[model samples]
Target: MAAPALGAQEAAAAAHMLSLPAEAFGNDPNVEMVWAVKAYQHAQVYFNLISSVDPKFLKLTKADDQIYSDFRKRFSDLKIDVLDSEDMKSGPAKEKWRPFCLQFDGVVEDFNYGTLLRLDCSRGYTEENTVFATRIQFFAIEIARNREGYNSVVYDSAKEANLGTEVVSSG
Candidate 1:
């Protein structure tokens, strides 16, 4: 009975494994690491838009789609704090995000794969500001952040002056 219980516990833990398997990053020579290129391009486009446009006017979803409002309704119960390392890496948060993100698997391109999300919405996608998240996790959090007015700092005059410079200087 104890052996069975331990197996069950392990199975449960495995369900929430958030880290992408190393092999899944593409070991095959023919694949040629397209996922990496796609992820990098995705980050560039995201940062380019945020660095220049006011978040309020930024439209991530189609006009009819309600991803932003839907994220608010579904995850309202979760206490979203500073969106620090814990929210991106902790088991509890990953478990919660997994199902929510998986729901968009067929809808959003590369919904389950790792992508870059900026730690602070106002900042550029620099090594210090970036974090890894599933594509939908990035969308869900950013859509909500943009909608709730938390991302207004991107448009601040001082930041705007440095925005182009930051992206060019960033590695």
Candidate 2:
């Protein structure tokens, strides 16, 4: 059977992220950029595993792209667009930094045994002042029967040992 449409729970999660206090994420240099990269990588790995076992879990659409685009737009709004990989690495600036979008193409089965699209973001990195930091960001949305959807909880290197319940919600 065809996969179900995106559901309220998924929407709520997305909205919750949008409503988060930006200050919660500090720009401390010790934050270890690797955390972001690891989170995205783990999310992608989970997507791959789920898609291989069941092809009815996640589904991607034009709207999915729009969601990503909107998130990217926030960088511009924050006046940090210059920090964006796309704008920072060009022409003479190519030697300094570069940004990349994560890409994934896959399918998975949902709890109800329906097919869904798996949208993923891969690893991206930038080099500045001879220092390189990797930033990876991605999301997996599983669409089940009855038009319900939920996202996979992403874990980072920091949470690896503890296997804690904290979910990485952003790139």
How many pairs of residues collide in each model?
0, 17
lDDT of each: 0.66, 0.32
Q: What is the lDDT of candidate 1?
A: 0.66
What's the CA error at residue 10 for candidate 2, in Å?
31
Q: Give the TM-score of each candidate.
A: 0.65, 0.22
Error of 1 at 130 (Å): 1.2
Candidate 2 to truth, TM: 0.22
Q: Quote the positional error of residue 127 for candidate 2 in Å.
A: 15
* Model 1 per-residue lDDT tens digits across residues 17-80: 3244557545654233334445666787776676678877787855214666667777885443
Please name the candidate that would achieve the greatest lDDT relative to the true structure.
Answer: 1
What lDDT score is found at residue 68 in candidate 2?
Answer: 43
* Model 2 accuracy (lDDT, Cα): 0.32
